[model samples]
Target chain A: MIKNVYDDEVPKVVTIKETVIETPTVKTFIFPFEITEDIHPGQFVMVWDLNNEKPMTISVIDKKNNLMGITVRKAGPFTENMYENMGVGDKIGIRGPYGHGYELSGYKKVLAVGGGSGIASLAPLLSFYDNVDLISAASTKDELVFVEKFKKENIQVHECTDDGSYGFKGFSTELADELLKTGDYDIIVGCGPEIMSYKLLELSQKYDIDCQLALDRYMKCGLGICGQCCIDDTGYRVCVEGPVFDKEQLGQLSEFGKYRRDAAGSIVEY
Target chain B: MLKSNILGMNLKNPLFLAAGILGTTASSMKMVARAGAGGIVTKSFSLEANDGYENPTIVKIEGGVINSVGLASPGVEAKKEELIELEDIRDETPVIASIYGDSEDVFCEVAQRTKDYVDAFELNVSCPHAKCGFGSNIGEDPEMTYNIVSSVKDSIKDVPIIVKLTPNVTDITEIAKASQEAGADALTLINSVGPGLRIDYQTGKPILNNVLGGIAGPMIKPIALKCVYNTYKTVDIPIFGVGGIKDYKDVLEFMYAGASLLQIGTSIMYDGPEIFKNITDDLSIFLEENGYNNVTEIIGLSHEL
Candidate 1:
């Protein structure tokens, strides 16, 4: 059974029950114990690979079987270490189910957009909401993940590949724009590259649709004190106030798609 | 219950959110106030926007974390927006703008630009990891520290000027005396300590991108207490004690060590914004248990020995 970590700040050692290789870079590590807290869609947990603690979204939460899962892409040092060395039964520290998740209760029809590894974050949302139009995009056909999982659940899925290897030969935002014109979606939820989310923000405004975008930023302490995850000029902390933000809130951010601060707090082109 | 006054600004308590930790935005600043800080010091800003450094700016070590954020700021004009938001909360929580610059004139310019939106100015001459000739470089030299503080004091009228001092020096009181002589209304003791480093065993490279950064957290608490304890003897102005402060016990220690106000930074990372209220509540209980009616009764009590 996976050990449950009680504290928000302290890490609890949990045994990895299974590891599923989703793609070349992305993998899902499942834990045996249930996180008793109600982890909403778009919420994340800080995983400690012993080298460093990093934030990752909850890709799967199985309460009945007492299991939890997180999908990770080998994007940085910490994730790369996990991909290369970690295996089932390997004990890794996990803390928190932090941040406000997607508020998907009132919406009748919804559109979900996921880009690259962002599909993992969208998976839980698709599971919770029945009427979701899912768009999964990747750089290549093989890189596209969770296509079969969505199909198995009988959810309608749209695929997009930047290299034109799959369903649509364009960006996910472009596909979302095309879908927005025809489908009447009450709310659009997205998690991906900043540029895509920024574009989605624009399209949401253009289409007059309510949208929520899950944002990523450099975070230290997930509990809102470390200002590392702050958005430019606006001062909203992605760790606390977001990681998931509605269209109106994202509009106020000046650095949305244009820039992001590095770990050193240096602004770099996103 | 723990009301205190420092530099003519009234405070509900001695606790403040230190600059450069979580003071970047007005919303976060207001959150800190709502969480129970007597005042909020903004993340240090300059005359122009600075990108700071690259990735791996802050690394957590055993005792604390080392950060070389390089003072990344949105410049004063952009920072004014956050300051304006802070103005709405100024009545509940006083706002202090922490400003840093390369020269005395630049410091004066930033002070002039931001003076209207804040209750006071904290001259940041003590950040150990900032670019050369800006942070500790200006602070380490008595004459330079005097020049910067006096220049800022001259440029701004009616606003209290607080000099934030570095602990890297051999004699902190020397610098503290210099700041007092130069007309500083108050002082915040000890920025982070050392251009510290943490090397990754597998990579065999420094963990921080800047190679070296200032250390803040539990490791520096003793040093900060000592700096405040000693500097209180040298300067008559109020001292804002900061460094590794975590709980109500640390608050009492700082108060006994002669700090009129306490600034919390690294602890906020571990405990979150609620730490202010937690510490304040616990402190109130400790004071009542000890039969102390006012927090000032214990200020500098250790010096009597």
Candidate 2:
């Protein structure tokens, strides 16, 4: 695939154009971005809000409007700061669109699944391609991100929430497994919890279907020099080689579903 | 002819990925090894876990970056897994563990734990921004430098010791000589040059969480060359040059200044890991064209002149 590589370590100041409350826990912050690099879905940027910096996947890529958006889940200190003080007209810095994005061509049918805020990375795929369906999962109905927008786009939406407060009760992989039984798909795209991706990977292997999974790990230098985001086994930097990996690539990672390193590089099993 | 065997490690070339940038994991170190680095230096770790600084640990300036990662280490226990992974590639690429401590006891303890995996240990006594007397506090003093070097060098079995010295001192050669006397196998000339600070014009505040960070990149090359050149003349051991090496030309200058082994850091921040292959390939082309037999012939050319 002809992927766009937009990576600059120097932080570029950008004004916040708007912010959308996707859910109670998630928000999509829109900003005016010069689309110089031919970027695609699943590529992320390091967002610097003056006080702190964190990696956020590009959720909205509106080329015509010259605008971009990042959907953030307010889970940690960085996100908490954004929710409390950041808004329209507030200036922030972005330095990448780092790592390889999902490859969209040469596939007839695709099943894209996202859990909670993980759907943000897959949101752009809906607009980038055709004949692709989505499995949007979260803990509760209010927690499902980008569902209304996906519904507006008239694409197939399979909603699954763990609390049975939304669509299919239980895990997103369970819903995906049932869907695989019901229909045949060329590729299954997953982004969310590592456990869900692991289960989906097993399902893909079981049904003999190809898959792509996006990974989110503790990273320091989103530029790939820190080695904080490097996965075990292949030693591939998640910042460069992936945040998204195919079924074959995902299989090479021993730490994919089992465990990951904390901020201090200590092993923490999932 | 770019290959060299130094201090028990067979190097495929004279180029290595410096510590603190991308040396956090075994997988990452292996990635660098596959990318064509002669050796790999794991990021500095200690006896206990340290969170380091908060956000804004690194920032870019004109010539290079000012970073105070605060020597964030996962501790010896956690980092041992990464060091152990390096054993698989010990033949093709030797692994160097860059370690730090507030005293000689912690230094020996950390090396003792992970000594089995790494081929050598690069003492990180030169980090200008490390807090609580952990880094430069010991390096600046000749006695402390000798004490730590001797303590760790004496305790670790079969592993060579390379002392990384800071240029932010009255005379680096004194520390270099002390390290050599204390049984250091080699010396790494000049860690980051400054405890520099960058204040954002927009916010009127410091860019780094620690307020001050070490300076690295092309800006510190001349100083690094001076240190390498001076130390090479004083000490009997070899020198590892590390400061703002961006391209083959930079590596060439470092070797000429008396650095037998070279490390590439800060530049790898913006440039990809491919920098290793690019620099090595270009160095090879330069060597072939210049009619030099190998990389070893060029060491200390400036000093001879």
Off by over 4 Å in 1: A1-112, A123-134, A137-156, A160-189, A193-213, A218-223, A231-236, A245-270
User: Which of the CAPRI classes, incorrect, acceptable, medium or high, describes model 2?
Assistant: acceptable
For model 2, state the Cα shift of residue A8 in Å: 7.3
- Per-residue lDDT of B151-187 in model 2, one digit per residue for the tens? 8877986899999999999999999999999999999
Q: Which 10 successive residues of model 2 chain A have the least lDDT summed?
A: A1-10
Tens digits of per-residue lDDT for model 1 on A184-259? 8878899998888888888888888898999998776575665878785556789888899987788888888887
Return the TM-score for candidate 2, rounded to 2 decimals: 0.93
Superposed on all Cα atoms, model 2 deviates from the true structure by an RMSD in Å of 2.9
DockQ score of the complex predicted as candidate 1:
0.19
Determine which window of 10 residues in candidate 2 chain B has minimal summed lDDT: B200-209
TM-score of each: 0.74, 0.93
The DockQ scores of all candidates, in the order shown, are 0.19, 0.40
The TM-score of the first chain in every model comes to 0.93, 0.94
Candidate 2 residue pairs in backbone clash: A4-A38, B217-B244
| Model 1 chain A poorest ten-residue lDDT run | A1-10
